[model samples]
Target chain A: MSHPEQAPEGRRRPASPTRALAEPPTTRTPETTRWRICREVIIHRIDDEAVAYDPGAHEVLYLDADAFEVFKQVDGTRDDAAIFLELAQQHGETTDEVASRFAPVLAAMRRHGWIGRTHGADEVS
Target chain B: MSTASTIGGRDVGPALDGYNPARRASCPAAPGPESPTYYRIGAVTVCLHSADARFREPFHHLYQRHYIGGPTLSAVHIRVDRVIRARPLGRGFRICVDGEERFLLRKPQAVLPHVEWAINAAVAATLPRYHQLHAGVVARDGFALVLPAQPQCGKSTLTARLISRGWSYLSDEFALIDPDTLRLDPYPKALCIKEGSFEIVDAFCPTAGALPSYEKSWKGRVRLIDPQALRPHRTPWGVPVGMIAFPRYVARPAPALHPLSRARALFQLLDVCFTFGRYRAATLDVLGGVVERAACFQLESGEIDATCDVLEAAWRAHVPASGRPDPADLTRPEEPVRPGVEAA
Candidate 1:
């Protein structure tokens, strides 16, 4: 269990362009995580343009856009604390709040066999 | 009974989903006589709960909730337990049957045609490495034939005819391939015996089994000929694809076989595909692998007997003539998957 540095800008919320143009966020209820058989391996859009894959055991697990963004923030070069602060600044959320949200998403992804846990220099650094 | 439910973020009741008021002005529940019994396919699986029936032949009713009347002969009901948006074309419709998401479709509406298509799509999409073909696959004595034909080209009729003559019907519409082993996965189901072909079937097998024909489709009338009626001899797990035949039924007294270049056959198969543009890269990769290994032939048959003869001869030429060899002997290793390749 580790903590990230506080954002220098303190806890300013990010202004999401998606939030302004979109409908108000429905209650962010937790979706029951399920492993849908990968029909097509799409690393793209959420709509019909998504790709399908028939998963083999050797397949790399993938994340949806929301999940992948959380994953992209993880760099082996940075410690959890540094990574948290950078992502919080990028998304304009408090470091603590961003880490709290990131934890559950990572847990969900790991549970679904998307990504395996890795210990690297970035986390130690 | 278009019960209310939510689909694609819209409060789509049965009526809205079926009639699509924008697509059709009048919303008629279109009452038709219900069949006395509902036939269940796929060997009775747990997904029965999600199955929706579509009348394909001898009946006009598809399902109680979803009904689109076209001249149909056989009906298939599929309960789609999961509709995930996974394909690049946005049509990754998978149905849970046989304990696997065996079917995959690129256009959502394509699965709506018949339950068999939905199930077939799921099976085809999930197979390892090999191309999922847009053709009917039938086999006999461990030898399999992939028939890729354009609509009105008598592919189904040929399938029914061959199945009647001891060929095991893999599927009347789809052919699934597994790249890992180069085996043709069996998706045995009903054959879409066209109206004109019905007479040919009657003449050939005289005792041929067929469902009733619906007189409402653009193709005059169509019916389904059950594969089981032919008493298929083998339930072989999978077969190596041996030949690719593009067949057309023209009302000529004579039949002709045309040797098509692999390129020509590939384009022809792609052209007849319902969702090639949607599946794009995956579909291209799959088909490309298949065409490379199998010999391609075009059959112009004016008569049923002549068509069968041409097929038999072609089979003799491409398939091992010694008979009943292990499927593993004929298969070739699959080509490596290229990176970031989007099929045009």
Candidate 2:
């Protein structure tokens, strides 16, 4: 079947905390997973809608849907491969193409704290 | 840098005109035969004038180029330059509609596609002092449907469908909220139709105009259509927003309406707002008050009939079946965020 491919690194099923410890400490800090909008500010979590809170101005920025999804998949547990697979599945695209097309965007998102990944569950083994 | 006035307890300022030569050419401040375009959402008077008639072809088309879409209206106001078009009214703003009174904002030049952005940003810029929301408002049977979506989530598609089903198109891009009464100010302009969905709309309602495609967009080519000719009716001013629904155009077997949690609802409302940061405290307070009162839900559907039925039912159940809300206090929540990313 020509289904969307999983992120090249492979998909990690949601595992228990025990599996998390065996992996190397994840470097996916907040900064590594912020959603960038208009190439200006970085936002976190956008599963629903997104509002940006500016500390200096004591104000909030509203993000449209496109920016919302791009920011929602930044959890450290999900690798680039997983993110690509998920987006592909949602929009109907092949994973290989998505990965090739999304690498730079994901990297840019990482620099802004929009996505992150940790050592595999079997890294210690 | 003139003194300030008050409207519904909010301070006011003088009308500021743009300096761009192109803009000046389109909208000269010199008194012309054309009357000033003023919109009264409660008490706030948004006075806009443009020398160019091309910008006025379709009321909402201007919004397509700027923001997403929302509730909007086009009307004429007759007034002497001394009072209606005068400098800041020292303290009291003229009351043209209902109990609400708002300060005046006048822009002499026509700013295409960017008009909605300027209007919404201006309203949001005064946050904490006033409330503003980034949402689309459509109405049927005196009640309005508020659709707040992240980009490319078929917001414009659903809006176009609602118009076909006889709902008055309030605004397709964004809805501006008044801080005092928690009412929605009309930012009605154009509808932004993205690719993939563009074909869907063309099939659903071929009569709606789809401008030539725009290329290289992440969502593919988008067309801005003037729903005025296609719309069934004019959305009444101050149509009480009865239902707040999030539309997801998934090709599923059936359309379902899922209830949303207040926290999640609040989170989403924040996400869909136009300029939460710009409005600050007022935006938060108004939005919070609205979310507290309105019913929030997620709509999953591939079929328009199912979606419409579910939406209509939700509206009748929550809102009074007799008529819509007072025109000034139509409150809307934020659209759903994708995931992990909270709603604006």
Candidate 3:
């Protein structure tokens, strides 16, 4: 747009701790990838949908019902594989099917710094 | 050296004619003695400094309701001045905002639009309080429909069509969402009719042809039609947002509206929000609230009349069956009737 949207202002909120670790979440993804929601990510949920904001990264994201369901599962206690397995069992699908369906969503959340790997999830917002 | 006084029972700031030329307020780009004109645009105070009538006259004419004959008291300020230079290379105008040069225009005719752009820039950068989105906003019966800006969207054309069809004009350029109330505030600048849709809009507004047009690089020419010329009065308060329609211009003979997911609307709106960077988390919060109760749609804009028909239907669908506010209600968020007085 040619309008007056200025160059994004300098980041005021704390930077995501996961920044130093990976470029795209895929490079750092291994079998034992524990994920945790970023401490400051604020999500506003609509009917089966949501919009997520990571203040540090200055990203506003929309979550479909599937993505919202997937994001809610990232509570820092379990690895991505385990979460997918549990979700698969709950929905009566195979682990591979669930992984293929939700792997991209997890990757996107990680890519946008809405979720971080296990070690970096302990930082205070 | 500005003063506030009343004219016809209305408050006015120090207008150019009555103000001292030697006293400069904010903008410093003008080279000669300056005639600074001030206007109150909602919660914002805009002061345009220029000695030339070409720039001042149009602003005064279009923004007549908001004109002030005195300086502002507490409103947010955005000041712009034009510096005309006849250099060895070419003649151009340097558009300045708040004592800083923001844009350089090669043609004098382009000064007005750039001045408006300068104001838009200042609002986006300076005001971290309001959630500013680059979109066209219009309202009906106290509820508003936000037309988020996009490539070839033809939002202004649709905005003019809506106004001609009895919808209130909030703005053709930006939607200022008040952070406190989470309501859509009026930026209510002129409805800019691009050259391509002149014939389409002129059919509804015939007097538009007599108005002078400006040269725009991509759009060829644009006429900034005053909103008041089309509508009698504007609701000078914040209105609740009821819908978000992302319009796309299609060559088909008829217009269409498709159901859009709230998530997608929020995503698209976030893309068009101008002050999203400044407000950060608050921007998302406000937008989420805005789209929460609003019906979202993707508008395939074809003919103006057909497009308006689709929009009016969408607007009508959102309103409750009873106690609907009047579309012409000059003030909105209608006072709830008392327990005993509701049915009367």
Candidate 4:
């Protein structure tokens, strides 16, 4: 069995904010870990926002435009490192700022079991 | 109670929770002069049987407006009988619905509220189709405004003030939303006002003082107020939803009303919503459509008079001079919540 908490080689927690933008922190997510939205979730779109219902868990949550955007990015194609950089560029924020902002939302979705992660991005489909 | 008129079009059978459909011989009603009173409140019909006529007079006084002449097939049966099991001075009453015992009470004052509560349960059991909310609904000009109220939220007080000021009374307890029509039907049950507000209510409803009081457990002493006294001939009926306001009573000079996104509003509403007969998908659809068409708001309500003013203003802003049927009446929900948006 593999340990999920074990960080990959050389990806350690950065000491400062400036160093964070360059080497984001290893605590938030593993660099090789890619997330995929659980396929069983139901979504009802209302304008830019969406009310996502998890049938398996029987729970509902409101995903505002920003959260929805972050959700859309979790296509199992990109790791958290890539997503943070992309959202950072789009929102005009540093990678560290975007990562911190996106962390809680991802936590909530994972808590709802709406998304799952796979390491090394191997056979993600 | 008409078979054709049952809520959600579901037939009345064993669906009534805890209702024993055994022949009336099994659990006989208390032996006495039982007065069977049939009432139709919104889409549900209830037939209540009380042993003593004088004992149930207060109930008649409060629910006089919603009474119907004849009985129907789908009616839920409630039997409140004074049963003296052991003690004579503190006699007990066995309250039953369709031959199943619901509540056993000894206090004379507790009878009325418990009977009202048993009727409340029967109504929900009878109408398994609509999604019911613990809300106070009032209408103006034909459009309904829903007050999604939680306990101690002053919903009863606010609703009474609005109705007394000429707003049509829909209900003070249940907001019945038909899943098919996506419209709210009135369930204008009497306003169960806590003792704290008796003086204020008596100011507008003079008869409130004369009505007998019941010591409702946890709620303290309560008096049931007939909504008709608050607004005459404000007959209950179906109305299109215009806005849903979640009010929080706080000390303030004027109430503050803020817009809410449909997603957020619908989620909050579902938190307090009960699906009686039908289940989830329909609730999501019915409530979703309501949120999409209606303006959702969160209010910090102050004194009743000022709060009414703020609520009226909010409703008027969404409904134009054209009287809410115009295509423009379909007001869009506020923008999607930005990151870290604070709730008001």
lDDT of each: 0.49, 0.49, 0.68, 0.69
TM-score-superior candidate, 3 or 4: 4
State how far residue B99 of model 2 sits from its true place (Å). 35
Best of the two (2, 3) by DockQ: 3
Per-residue lDDT for A82 in model 1?
64
Say which prediction, candidate 1 or candidate 3, comes out ahead on lDDT: 3
lDDT of 2 by residue, B1-344 (tens): 22233334543343222212232344323333254454443223344444333333222133222221222453222121213543463322231212232323233221233343344444444423334455667876665677877666677777887777778876776665656666565545556676667666777667533343433224444555666645545545655556677776677857888766444555566666656545544555566666555667777866766777887777766676575433234333444332222211
Candidate 1 achieves a global lDDT of 0.49
DockQ of all predictions against the true structure, Cα-based = 0.01, 0.04, 0.18, 0.14
B1-344: candidate 4 lDDT, tens digit per residue: 11111223443221111112232233323223444877787666767787444344445555655677677888878887767676564567778988899988866567777777887776655566678887899888778889997677878888998999888888887789877777888878788888988887888788677666776777888877778777786555767788889999887777888877777787677665655123655566778888887888888998778888988987787765345543344344455443411111
TM-score of each: 0.46, 0.48, 0.76, 0.79
Enumerate residue pairs that collide in model 4.
B128-B277
In the range B1-344, model 3's lDDT, one tens digit per residue, is: 33343334554333332233333243233322255667787656787776554466556677767877777654433344444466752546677777787777766556676677678778767854678887888888878888996535798888887887788888888888888887877877777777888888788888777666776566577788888777677654688887778888889979888777665577677777777766667766788777766777788888888888888877776654344323332111122111100000
DockQ: which candidate is best?
Answer: 3
lDDT of 3 by residue, A1-125 (tens): 32243334532222223332233444657667678886477776766667777676665666766677787888877788889988998889999998887776677666656677775545331
Error of 4 at B268 (Å): 0.6
Please tell me what DockQ candidate 4 reaches. Answer: 0.14
Model 4's interface RMSD: 12.2
Writing each residue's lDDT as its tens digit, candidate 1 over B1-344 gives 12343433565223212322232223343233232233333221112323222222112122222233342333333445335564464634455444545455443333433345445555444433345556778876576788876567777877877877778767677665665655677655556666677777787665443334533234555554556655535545567767888877666789887765444455455555544433554554555556656666777877777778888877776677455433334322132111111121
Off by over 4 Å in 3: A1-29, A37-40, A94-97, A110-125, B1-35, B74-90, B217-219, B321-344
For model 1 chain B, give the 10-residue run with minimal summed lDDT.
B335-344
Query: Candidate 1's error at B159, in angstroms?
Result: 0.8
